[model samples]
Every structure is written in C-alpha cells, then in structure tokens.
Target: MGQLRDRLMRRWTTARWTRRLGAGAAIALMVLSIQPGLGNVTHAKGATVNLVMWQQWGGGHEKKTLDKYIGLFNKSHPGIHVSEVAVTDNTKIVSAISGGKPPDLMDLGTTGTLGQWAHDGLLQPLDTYIHSSHINMGAFVPAGWHAVQYNGHYYGVPFMNFNVGLVYNKKLFRAAHITHPPRTLQELDTDAARLTVIKHGRIVRLGFVPDYPASNLEVFAWLFGGDWFKNNGRTSTAALSANIRALQWEQSFYQKYGRSSVKRFVAGFGQYLTAADGFESGKVAMMLDGEWNIAFVKENVKRFQIGAAPFPAPAGMTSRNGTSYIDTNPQVIPTGSPHAAQAFEFIKWETTNPALAAEYATLVVNLPQLKHVPQTSLFKDPNFRVFENEANGPNAHQLPQTAISSQFATNLGNAEEAAILGKSSARSALQNLQKMTQQEIASTH
Candidate 1:
C-alpha cells in the first residue's frame, strides 16, 4: 500500500514471541490501568460498543482517510465507537493476540500472511457472521474475496485491493513511432528495443524492466498460465513448465542488455514515489505497476501522458490478455476479541455500505473491493477505469492461500531475482524454489 513494503516478514521464533509477549502483557496491563472501560459493553440494546483498532499503515492520507471513516461510522452507528491506534510493528499485534488482549478490530495490512495467521488460530473465522448478517458474498471482487479465504473459510474482509498492469509513457511511445501498448511478449521485446536509448554503451533510458519497482514473478507467471501451488493448495508447483518459461522470459532482458550495464542503469533510479522515479521521470518507458501509479504520475510528472494496459500476454495466449496479479489490504478480528459481534458489525458496515465504501475508496484512490465500484462515477478517470476493469476481469488471480505463504512469496521472489540476474539458470532456480517451498510447507505444520 506504500512505496515499499512497510516491514519485512519476521521468523516465528519462540524467543521473539517471548519478548513480544512480555511487552504485550505490559501494554495490556497499562491500558487496563489507564482506561478501565476499553472493552465492549453488554449486548443489550442501545449499549455502546467501544472498539480499539490497531492499523498497519498510517500518518498521511491513510490516517486521514481512516479517521474520516471512523468519524462517519461512529456518528451513524451511535452504539459503536471506534478508537484507532497507528501500529507499525506487526510483532506487537502477534504479542497482543498471544497475550489474549488483542484489539477488537485489526487491519492486517498485507494479504501474504492471512492464511498463516488463520491457520495459527490468530484470527476469527467469519463464515458464520457473514451468513447471519446476510452479507452479499458476490459483491466483492473475486480475487480480493479469495485473498481473505483459507481452508474453506473466510478470515477477513478486503479493505482495498490492487491489480498491476503495463504502465507506459505515451510520449516515449510516440517518439519510438509505436502507436499502442504491446499486446504480446514478442511485440513487447520489439517495442522495448525501439524505445530503449543507449549512449556510449550505457543505458540512458530503459524500455522496460520486469523486476524493477517490485518482485513480479507472480505477475509474469500468471500471465504465462503458471502458478506456485496446486492440489487445492496442498503442494508447490514452482517448477511447472510455465513458470520456467516465465523465468527465461525475464532473463532475456538481462541477457539482451548486459546484466552489469542494466544494473548500473537501474542503480541511478530515484526512490519510488519521488520526482526522479524511473517511470515518473521518463527514464524508463514502461514497467509492471499497480493502479496507484496513475495518481502518482499525475502528481509528479508534468510532461508525459501515462497510459495503462494489461501486460502483454505470452505469444498465442490471447485469452490471457487481461490477466493480472491481485492482492489486498485485509481487515480481521483477532481470535480472542471480546467485541467480536460489534466488530463484525463495524467491518460489514465499512466494507459493504456502498456510500461509505465509495467515499473511502475515492479518498484513498484504491480499487474498491466491491463490484459496484466500477459502475460509479467516482473513478471515471481513464487510468482508474482500466484497473477497475482488470480487477473484475475473469483472468485476475491471487497467490495461493497457505500457512507458508510468507515463505513462498520470499522464496519465489528470490528465485525470480536469481534467474533475472543470471545467478542461476531458470530451470535450476525454479527447481530449487520448488524444493524450498515444499520444505516450508512441510515445516509449517
């Protein structure tokens, strides 16, 4: 949700948990002492349900938006009052949950650990709540909804979702005499060669860099009709032929442009979200990036006309033209929350209420998880429309939901990096990844 991931995934070590648990205990005691009535009251009619919510991303537009929502939520639902704390350290959340004093509402910030936390009994299942509340399950974007599920149950609700596509500078394309975004991998290579500018054997501008901005193995693999898991999420499929094909495709870039030369060219790129960002500054003609980049480019770049389209499909995979990788910022209630019912009410209201959901989505500039969002004029901008369309497209997918997902993402990302840098052959890297992920899954239990 930010320029870079907020925190690195931490190992689930006992010593680490012990330290966090101690701090959680201290924090719980202090909170109880200072505010004797922080928990939810009786479920009687008109009784106020006070909720303490700890969120992951805060202190800017995110904070402002959440505060606005809380204000609106509290005003409309007179019986529920929400107090939010900006929480950065995920270990503190685990500590609080482990110590049995978790917040009534938790914004889990990332989708990668949803399955892991749910399997560990750190989250409360919402199937019963959804059924009882008559929540319309089909209203959510399919991929975003899938991200909240694990082992046949939904553990959370999607807060906001994102899907990545090919973002290109129209000015650069015009300069290269390219009329449209490439629709196939072969065309992409031809366009990239035309758009790339080399001076003195050094790259002054790059046409595209697959792994730049973020590790995008998942995106490419999906485009190539590959996935990391199968057998209903019980096994690793990193070594699939399609995955190897994706890796070799990424390697072609490094192979075409010398690895060291490309490395040196990229090393000069500015920090993401800044004026000198590779794409924003027009130093890179194209990249695989999310919908947020549209707003970012509008704010930081003045001379370029930025456009978004589904990443080019592998040759002859015309059906995969709209394929994209989707992920979410999910919200969940901890297993031990005393205000589970009240929390569910707030969650459902915030996520499904069309008025509130639209306002929040507009303010945050994120793709609303709800299906109705695309029809609304709130996201009438062409760039937003492209992403909204892609989010609802049939080919959209999310990574597998599994207890070892964090490790899986890390390993596959490393495998992608290795193959791209020529540190390992694509087949060999994928084989290693397959073995490592299988071991992770085995160790998870």
Candidate 2:
C-alpha cells in the first residue's frame, strides 16, 4: 500500500502547497475553461493517442500492480497508449497544470483537493464522457460517488476507497478483562482508561492515542453528528455544536495524561509501518485506522491477535453507530491535456471494469470503488469484513466537497492540535477556525 502511505504523507504538506493553490493559483485558473483554444483535445480517426499519467505510488507491490493494469489497458485499447510515472511530490503536479502542460491522467491519492482542483478548472469535468460511456454512477459506493463530484459535475473517478474503524489488540483487551470491543463512546473511554498502563510516572502502554498515526478527529466529528461544512459544501460550519463536542472529547484524552507527557510519548513512538510502530509493538492498545491496517497487521504483526470493529458513536446515537470516514484514491484528467479523450478511455476501462477493479482493490487491500464487484478470497478476512460493512453503512461519509476543502482540512487539523495540546479551548480553536475559513472561501469567489 505504498500509494496509501503516500496519501497519508500528504497530511504533513497539505497546508503548504494546497493552501497556496487554494488561495492564489487556483483563483487565477477559475475562469480557464472559458478561454479560447483550451477546449478538450480529441484524436483523429484510427490514430493512436499517447497519454502521460502520474501517480503517487513510487515503488513496491502497489506500483507494480498499477503497472500491470496499465499494461493490460494498453494491450486492450490499441488506439490509446497510457504511460504512467511515479510523481509523489504534489507541487510538481500544481506546476505542470498551472504552466499549461499537465499529465493527461493523474491519481492525486485522496479527494482532499478534488473540489479545489475542479473549481479552479485544473481538472476537466467527466460528465459528458460518463454519459456517453453509459457509466453507471449507481454502481459505486455512495460516499465514493460523492467524493468525486464538485458543484454537480464529476471531476474525478474514485477507483480505490476505504473507511476507518477501531482496531484493538485482542490480547491486551483480554488481559484488561474486557471481553468485547467498545460499542459506544462512553464504553470506549472506560476501556481506554482500563487498558492504559503507566510505569515510572510515564506512559509505557497507552490505551489509545486519539491522534496517533493519522488525523481522526474528523471521524469523531462524524460520529458526533457534526460536519465541517453544510448547505452542499458552500458554507463553513467548523464550529458546529457537534464538532465542538467531538474536539472536547479528543482533547480529554490529552488532558487525562498531561499534554507534555502525551507529546513526549508520541514523540518517542516509532515510524508508522515499521516493526517498532506503537500499535505493532504493543505500545498502543487501540487505534483508529483504515481497512488497510487489517492487511498490514496480517503481514507484519505476529505477537498478538488484532480485532477490528466499527468506531463507536455517542451513547443513544444508534443510527450513527456504524459511521466511518470514507476516503478514496481519485484519478483525474487535468484541463488542457493533449489527450483528454484517450485519458478518459483508459480511466473508464481501469475503474469500471469489474475484473480489473476487483484485482486492483485486492492487490492494494482497498475497497473496490464499485459496489457490486465480484468477491474474492480477500473478503474472507474477518477484519476486512468489518470495514466492508462499515463502508456500505448508511452513515459512511467523505469530507465535505468544497473549493476550500484542502485548506479547511489544514485549519481543522491545526484547531484540533491546539485544543488537544491545551494551547486553547476547543470552542475557541474551532470558532476562530470558522471565521478564517469562511473568509478564505469568500475570497475564492
């Protein structure tokens, strides 16, 4: 899952390039589609159209799997030749598109910037091609379909997706006298407290690290019935009451252990995907992670049994019990590509083909973007089944699709960090974020 890891790494740099793009270059490109000589490029009759494609997965099984598929695509579609290159740095993508020379196709890892990219005319809409190709939009998971759309237009295709859940060490739970994973938020807190182990006035084994390894405050916000945006992703609602409650809940974990103590503990944690990783090393008992973690544990961890369950919702929120944050690896054709038609041809074949979609998802351990893909042996993995159910659940959702989505996520992360580290109250952090993001959105228009 190198591509998945690459997507995760985007969190560190999103606020930089994405922020600048959202504020500056993106604004300049907002009217690019209306410019003459910028229309979609089509191929001549029976002529081969060559396309350059870029993606984040640099090497390993993930890249090889994609290469295999691209090979298959090239072989099948003789009229279109799609060549892929591993380009992990997003700034290069921005530069290429802004300079009017962009790859025909690209997989941007996540939908975090889909809205901004589409709104700024960096990506060409696929609605016409989709309609002409008879692509069944209903074949996708609802959240996956939603993630690829901005302003009622389809700008990208979600090929691989996953939703997060609670993963716990069964051995640790049994030792703590817990028979089952928590099914409600209250039980989660109690179990975390019970499973935590302290020694020499330091945390040696933590019950849970709310922000460890990834950003999950958004998941908590979903569970608490809050969202960062509403009214079809046009307005900022960063300080929604439910969102504030979720932040408070996340901050409580840091408050339970002193901020300095928690910070030091997290600082000492090993790099993710390594043997010394906190969860893999048994230094952390519980975590909120995507379905890919199931395969990671199966391949990497041998010391204990790992269990996965739906992330708990607040008490009495039965309707929200199975909620998970739906995330995707979305592919798009940049505007002004010389081979937009051929690029769509290849993307359609890669994403909509049942056999290929199933194979790709299995190779990467991702949920197939299509809903009715034929099940393979991968479905038999119990932990994966838990996430599969969560992905199909009604409450599963992606982040709001807005032109400022990338910046919104960056601001939200900052707010969560401030609140969790005790630099400011949750309400104050969120309220301030609300005003700033609202202003950013307004300026974009």
Candidate 3:
C-alpha cells in the first residue's frame, strides 16, 4: 500500500512539471514574436523624455514647415520625442501656465512679450542653459539678442529674425520716370507725390503708403530717432520730440491725400495674403513690409518685377541710413516645464545647426537668427538678398524691451491712426499716448 501511494505522488509531480515547461515555452515564443516591435516604440525603456512644443504659427505653410523640421529632430534624437501643439492665442498659453499644464517649449511670436512674462516670474532665465550648452551668444544678431534679453538675463532663444524693407514695383517706378529708389524719407515723399495718379476727380493709384499691409509705429519712430521708452526702458518716451516728428510725418501722407480718400482706398484693398493685395494688384506702387512679402509676391503675384530696398531714413539723419526694424519669434521654456533641459537641447539644435537653421529660414521666408546661416545660397537669392543685407547692416534696431511693449505698440498705433485721420494733432495724440504708457508702466511695477 505504501509503494502504491508513493507512485501516485510521483505521477502528480511529473504532471505539474510538464505543465510548467509547456507554459514557459509558450511565454518564450510570445516574447520572441514581440521583439521586432520594441524598436518601433518611441518611448520604450531607456532614458526617454517626451516634450511638448507650443507655437502660434497655425497657418498651413508655416505649420507644415515647422512639422517637417520637428520630425527630423525626432528622428535624429531617439531619446527625446517632441509633440507640437498650435496654440494660436497668447491668452491660452497664459491660462495653461496658470493651470500648471504649460508646454515644455513655446515659440512666442515676438520677444516683445518676454519682458512682461519675465517680470511676472512666468519665464525661466536661460542663462544657465545658454552657458552649459556652450552656445555662443555672439553668433546671434545683435537685434535678436537684444530682443531676447530682459533685466540683464536671457529668457529665450531667437529662432528667426525679420526686418521691414521698402518693397516696390519696378514697373511702377519706370512708368513714373523714376530711375532709382529713394534713399531718404524726403526723397520718398517726393517720389510718392510724383508717382501718384489722379483721374476724373478721383485718386486712382498711390505711389507709396506708409501704413499699408500694417502699421509699423516702432519702425517709423526709430527712423525718427525716437522710441517708446527711456532710461533703460523704465520711463515712457512716447511723447518725445522724435516720436512727434515721426507721427507728423505719417500724418502728412494722409493730409496730402485726403484722409477720407486714403481710408476709402485702404478699405477697398484686399487681404495681404491673397492675389488681390493692393501692392501686388498695381493699386499701390510701394509698401513698407517684411521679407515674407517676397514669398507672397512670388506665389501670388507673378506678373510684375518686384524690388526691395532699405527703408529710407530721415534726410540728414545719415546715422539712420540703411535702418531697419527687426523682430523675432523666440523659443522659450516656461517656468514650470518639466522638460526644461530637454527643451533647451532642441533649441540648441535648431539654433546652432546650420543646415536646420537655413532650412527653417528658407521654409518660412524669414531671416535666420544665426549669423552664419544668412550667408547660405537660399538667403542670397535676388528676391531675398535685400532683406538679408538690411538685416546684417549696422542700423538694424529691435523694439524696446519693455514689459508693456505690446501695450505701448497698441497705444502708438491708436495715436497714429487718430493723427493720420486728422482727428487729433500729432502733439495731442502723442501726449495722450505718453500718459497712457506711463500709467501702464507704473501699474506693471
């Protein structure tokens, strides 16, 4: 009886061992089958960090180009995966950060907001990252570097730079018997007067419109040796003599061509991106715009010969000759971003890598922030060369880095419109702007 019981126990143990072996073989086969899929997973096991990059560039071409470069970055750095989100409104970014769910990286349209955000303690100073990454700050253009700096600290990396140029129609100039583009503001006015045409008691075409496409108050203010701030951007200088002169000069155009007529003409104009653009449609001969117009003209208006020149300076202001106003779309890491280090890694790559920088600039038709990238063949093309040269020139100036810069710009625009429409004198408009700007500056403090 004892021998029979031991034989039964042995049989049970053998059955259990056979089942275990069969289960182990099945597990091994399953693991082998899934081995080929491991590499396909972007965030597998070893030291992978995912980041989110938020930007306001939601236009079709802009988003497409940005995504292309982002894909390239992801393919090159397997350890880091960056997801891009197009948050077109700045208020959304503020709300997200306030909600503690901010993106790791952001492409704020212009560095004008850097001061306000930095002052509000919403931005992380990138000095450490800039130094640790061995980034040569000198490699960036002065205007770009200036735009990103606030209170003696760098808060962002400037990715693209753009300056306003005098985009003109060559055919229009020839028809007006003008052989050369204006080199001074006085000459520009003369050209405008000469090139304007009137028929049947109605203004038919304007030679140049200073505020067409958009109102660039800062550019005109700078051209007149003025700015919105003084004393290292602590005080409002909106009512300075130079700014008043700039406003008066702008008002002169509307004064010469009846304000109602100019307004009616502008109202009748089409959107800037479409083929019906006033400048492209030969309704306007010249306009003060950025380099992106080169791409727009190429794609939308192909029937004319387009030319670009430096925005002429005030006569006798030789120092302002070749002057251009520069603005940049800088990449910043929010204060509480969990992936700040990884975000900097990508910023470093995008700014320092020549090929990537050039490709981005070319794709967007904007000037590259990196000094070396402008010398590439893409920027040297005839349509783009004028802007490239003006960007590299000594007279390129960035907007004043004030916490209330956007507000200041808005106030100036309002004042400009009022003065140009003959509703207020330049002095009164600017004085009002000064009061408003000062109040805003004080409130921020």
Among these predictions, the greatest TM-score belongs to 2
User: Which candidate has the top score in lDDT?
Assistant: 2
Residue-level lDDT of model 1, residues 218-332, one tens digit each, is 8788889988788867798999999899889999999999888888888899988666978888888989887777656665667668888888897899889867878888889
Q: Look at candidate 3 and tell me the lDDT of residue 181.
A: 90
Candidates, ranked, lDDT: 2, 1, 3
Reference-based TM-score of each model: 0.84, 0.85, 0.83
Candidate 1, poorest ten consecutive residues by summed lDDT: 1-10
User: What digit string (tens of lDDT, one per residue) describes model 2 on residues 253-292?
Assistant: 9999888898898888787755578888888899988776
CA lDDT, every prediction?
A: 0.80, 0.81, 0.79
Q: By summed lDDT, which 10 consecutive residues of candidate 3 come out lowest?
A: 33-42
**Model 3 per-residue lDDT tens digits across residues 140-181:** 777787888988998898888888888898999999999989
**RMSD (Cα, Å) of candidate 3?**
14.8
- Which runs in model 1 stand beyond 4 Å of their true positions? 1-50, 56-59, 99-101, 302-304
- CA displacement after TM-score superposition, residue 267 of candidate 1 (Å): 3.8
State model 2's lDDT: 0.81
